[model samples]
Target: MALSVIGAGFGRTGTLSLKFALEQLGLSPCHHMMEVFANPEQAPVWLSAARGETVDWDSLLSGYKASVDWPSCHFWRELAAHYPEAKVILSTRDPQQWYKSISGTIFPAMAGGLPEEGPQRDMLTMVRHIVSDKVFSGATDQAHVLDVLARHEAEVKRSIPAERLLVFDVAESWEPLCRFLGVPVPDTPFPRTNSSEEFQARLS
Candidate 1:
């Protein structure tokens, strides 16, 4: 397969919008946590992958040309191992704003609702398992959240080739992304999504 795209961004980082944009750009068959939401059956498959247990990559990667958000984010290091040549996108936003958005809405929405057998459930489990390590830097505080972003940034820089790793801020629009991906720039504003209110309402 050609180089696939992986979103290393956490939830609430405009990953959904990016997923849609990539699809519009001809990167179809992408995977996202929302896919897990819509299809609960993929949970166990994701759980095994996140735990570094054996999984059928051919079957798993068969349908998706790209993957974003949780579970995918959780297993990025693993994905890097599998698709060593795949492009990695590190989506970022201001740390405080991200924390506010996540704490207020995203986390609340997913709590206690993921299916035990499906991918969504597996994502919830995987995220919780790694939040302290990946998103919180083994600590839980406002400072820790910032630390997570910083550490993740550093890790990606160290692990992936500079050319293979792209740092994209959703607010910056498509030009930079298009340039990096070698896709023609679409004549449209980058899609902005997942307001705090919208995320909060999902919880209800």
Candidate 2:
């Protein structure tokens, strides 16, 4: 199935929660970085894409109705063009908090190397190429990283048609998202997950 929702937001910007929220809104099978970790077969395909090679987006993302966060977010432009009908979600947060969250969670995680070679290792490698090098330009300084985040958000807003994009913050919850997708808001509370502490605990 083709993607109906494409997330242009970087990781640590409430993407994990957005994944669940989207699924709850009937967009199940949302793709996230964690999906690659859970499925080894998907790693190499992403690694290939990370290296700047053209890929069959459909084959790679087959069965997924939506995508969010890293790896996918890194290729948002391509995915947007490929799935023209898909609406873009630019998930965001306070700039300083976004920096702090990534600093505490994903930054150190990607800085370390896996002990042995495997699919997960390959996945980390792809992430490093995309997140560490390409996205952040290999600089983790507060100034630089925050700048990248701001520029990314601005670019998404500029490139995607205003009508087709929703600048979302998970804190705002389901109404905005539900309204954007033309779906009824669930009676259930929005999914709020993957906080910095939880992310650190998982890595530990």
Best by TM-score: 2
List the candidate 2 regions with Cα displacement exceeding 4 Å: none
lDDT tens digits by residue: candidate 2, 8-64: 999999999999999888889999988888886887888788788889999999999
TM-scores for all candidates? 0.85, 0.97
- Candidate 1: residue 9 Cα off by (Å): 1.8
Give the 10-residue window scoring lowest on summed lDDT in candidate 2: 112-121
lDDT of 2: 0.92
Candidate 2 C-alpha error for residue 183, in Å: 0.7
Q: Report the number of the highest-lDDT candidate.
A: 2
Listed per candidate, the RMSD to the true structure in angstroms reads: 2.8, 0.9
User: Which regions of candidate 1 fall more than 4 Å away from where they truly are?
Assistant: 1-3, 110-127, 130-140
140: Cα error in model 1, Å:
4.2
